[model samples]
Target: MKLGKEYQQLTPEDFTINPEQPEDFQQAIAQLVTQSTSWHGVVQCCGHDFTGEETSVSETGYGSTLLLVQALVKAELSPLPRLWLVTQGAQPLDSHPVMSGVVKSSLGMVKTISSEHPGLRCVAIDLDPQQTVEEQARMLMAEIWSESREDEVAFRQGIRYVAQLIDSHWTQSTLTVQQYQFLQQIKTASISERQNILRDYLQSEIVQVLGMNHEQVDLQKPLNDMGVDSLMALELRSRIKTHLEVELKISKFVEGVSISDLATEVNEQLEQIETNQENNLDNEEQINSAEGNNIDWLEGEL
Candidate 1:
């Protein structure tokens, strides 16, 4: 029997949350942890004048894996800096003498970096060679300042809302029509549901729009590689709005580093957009009502 068919027979209870086997249900989570390391190397290399580094570590996915596991744990548990080395996967490593010393050394390194250094920040832009550093910085500042005080408050609230969504599995819960549409617009599937609506749209609409090939792209790659240049980033913004019929901020690119990360970021922005729109409508109605009341009072005085 095939592994796919056999794996389908497993139950959620078979993979309960525990310290012993954290990577049980969320393999994607583990994969993200690994990919984050590769992404870190790539980003670091691209940022500096270096050809990528070479190390004989079997765990090429170490950097991303460490960053994500730490982030998720911090987000879920303590907000402090710490690290964990998981010991279960398709290729398991025994807790033997050869690996034990290395694992301890790695943990020590994680603790040092997590405590001393601020985490890396990933950013995306839609600019060409024509834009100077000063020009780009000015543009970013203007965009940041465009948000009124009220919008800024709503934006922070939107981040909390997104944290909640991730806390809950991406289930189709109760949502407004627009919220539902936004979810549908960026929906992507794992290996199982690759042919489903969300994944299909991601491949054709998003992947094609960004000029990425199916073969060259894997689910784990950084989303920026999908021709996510400045123009394509704006194109993604426009397409998302057209498909979902909701406006979202471009700053979400700075927050989400990978394709999965981008999905989370977009969802958060969509929630913020919805909330802001609702608040604006309510304020407009209140203003109109107050104006009518003032006109009625003047008429009575006359």
Candidate 2:
């Protein structure tokens, strides 16, 4: 198969790969692993020849790449700062059965690895064959160095598409005028009423973040089990702190904690803070009243 102009343009420094012999392939990988030791971040481009049909050669190639990545991860003395997997397929990579199978399988593996090794900051990039090698290389390099937290990126027909998952929770410390008025109206409401309000707020936030409907979210189910990763958890925490002015530990948002439990905790903290504020204001007023009485008595004597 003829190499694409983009692939031809890539230099040895750009990427290192050897498919001729097992020892050479291992040696090239060792060099990469050694180079990665000093580098803060490493981006591995798993280039494959998509020309072949679904055959033993393609299967072995894909398996070899997977094992190499596993070896890199295992060889690292410390967790890698970031790991990016770049896979290229001809235009409509998903349409070709052989290429699609490999890409999909790779995607699943990367996603699982990302979940298991959160510190690796794993991401997958799918390159379009329609675009020039130059375009693909440029985009891939930018993504590797960019401080984007996006988990999935695709370059289709020279356009870049990024998909980021985040909670839609409002992160404003101060409520809007309308929200403030609504809260004021319900200040004298029962604890259950307040809890219900918070619960609804949290439910909406989770639904928006998870891209699901309110009915789909089980209040009692753990958020992690529902595919809420660390990034999502952090976003939720930020939203809660900003909206409710309640500081929650990161641990509270992890796997074992349910949304219902989180909402209840937030409500309790909000109530406690409000109660303390009210108590302080009452004490201040009492002190002022006492001082006024003393001043009035002194003035009469004078």
Candidate 3:
């Protein structure tokens, strides 16, 4: 361990998991967890996308990442490590609009994982791809060690920026009256209706962002194949989270997932949210009823 602090290196080989079963990934990481009784932090530098022959980013960024996160979740360590996922050009900065590769997808997974495992203190940092390796390394190392809680961060021209989804105001006065009414009723709409709305909203955003005509977007076609780069995918994911209250998976946006598939995923999230809400209400009612019975018993004793 460098700096005399307990740190652990989880290699690429250590990130292995069976697609059919998760036991190996779990056991491997559990052993790593035992190596440190309590860890100060853990850093994972997911490598950059291929430039030449293969020309694909999913295997490195998507599936393997899924495995690694699952392993960490399964390990069930007592004191979870503060995880920093470092990548080159993983996020979108205003100055640099070329959002490409699995790094961006990693950010999506980070958001989901952070919400599900708040103790992990997970964040994804995107380096300025144009900068020299030494410069990027210095900045990345500094940010990783710093006590910053910024979730998704990116560097542009030596400045750091964190991702935030500002409430969109541009939708006003742009759509027909019926569409406006639909927006007002979206939350109360049926599951199928909500899915349709999400699909329509995505289509509109894609058309506007990509400079494509209304007829050009194909819902069944993969966003990646339609030239949906990281910047576009990030924006789309942000808008979906802000408007529809669903964090669309990286696969839905990056790894050749189609618009129809995204809508279905959104619908499933909505259903899960509804189920959770009902369960909470039932629990509250039961608690209240028990409290009332206890009060009656105390009065009878008096």
Instruction: Give the number of the best model, judged by lDDT.
Output: 3
Better of 1 and 3 by lDDT: 3
> Which stretches in model 2 have alpha-carbon errors above 4 Å?
1-36, 57-61, 90-99, 163-302
In model 3, where do residues sit more than 4 Å from their true spots?
Answer: 1-24, 50-58, 94-104, 167-302
Those runs of model 1 whose alpha carbons end farther than 4 Å from true positions after fitting are 1-200, 210-217, 224-238, 241-256
Could you tell me every candidate's TM-score relative to the true structure? 0.28, 0.41, 0.44
Winning model by TM-score: 3
Estimate the TM-score for candidate 2.
Answer: 0.41
Clash pairs, candidate 1, are 33-64, 33-65, 34-65, 36-64, 37-63, 37-64, 126-230
Backbone clashes in candidate 3 total 1
Question: For model 2, how does the per-residue alpha-carbon lDDT over 1-302 read when each residue is reduced to its tens digit?
Answer: 11122222144344333433344344544555555555456565665565555555324344544554565555653434566777776224334344555655656767876665555667877777666887677667656654445677666544455544453111222444233334443354578888787778888888988899888998899888888888888888887765656798888878588888887898788778777876864665466557656877999999
CA lDDT scores, all candidates in order: 0.37, 0.61, 0.65
RMSD of each: 25.2, 24.5, 20.7
Candidate 1 lDDT over 192-250, as tens digits, reads: 34234433454456667756567765554565654466666677777766565545566
